[model samples]
Target: MDVNGRVWLIEANPKPGRTLFIKTGERKVYRTSVRRPLQYAMF
Candidate 1:
């Protein structure tokens, strides 16, 4: 998701029920979410 001037990639695993996150700036041109809550929303 794109927020402010940055983006975030969220990954979700169904089998293990876990989530992962990565900053879009750190990702490649097109390297790509889970249902986990986003903390940035508070900001």
Candidate 2:
């Protein structure tokens, strides 16, 4: 963030750590995150 309190996105990771949500006990989110891309590709 800057002096005016505006946030900036300086970088992004194309492949973020996948196990984070799992570690946080968000099993449903983890499953959906892994599933959606495969479903989209199959469609």
Candidate 3:
């Protein structure tokens, strides 16, 4: 964000860390994160 409070996305990761959610006990999110792309590709 800048002084005017406007947010900007500078970069993105295609393959992000997958274990963080599991370490934080967010199993559902971890599963969805792993599954959604496969589902989309299948369709």
TM-score of 3: 0.59
Superior by TM-score: candidate 1 or candidate 2: 2
Instruction: Give the Å error, residue 17, model 1.
Output: 17
Pairs of colliding residues, candidate 1: 10-33
After TM-score superposition, the amount by which residue 42's alpha carbon in candidate 2 deviates from its true location, in angstroms, is 0.2
TM-score winner between 2 and 3, please give it: 2
What TM-score would each prediction reach against the true structure?
0.18, 0.61, 0.59
lDDT of 3 by residue, 1-43 (tens): 7899897877767666888899999999999998997898588
Give the whole-model CA lDDT for all candidates, comma-separated. Answer: 0.40, 0.84, 0.86
Instruction: Tell me the tens digit of each residue's lDDT in model 1 across 1-43.
Output: 4667776758644653232224334333223223224444545
1 or 3, which is superior by TM-score? 3
Lowest lDDT block of 10, candidate 2: 9-18
For model 2, how does the per-residue alpha-carbon lDDT over 1-43 read when each residue is reduced to its tens digit? 7899897978767577778889999999999988997898588
| Candidate 1 Cα errors over 4 Å, as ranges | 12-43
How much is 9 displaced in model 2, in angstroms?
A: 24
Q: Ranking by lDDT, best first? A: 3, 2, 1
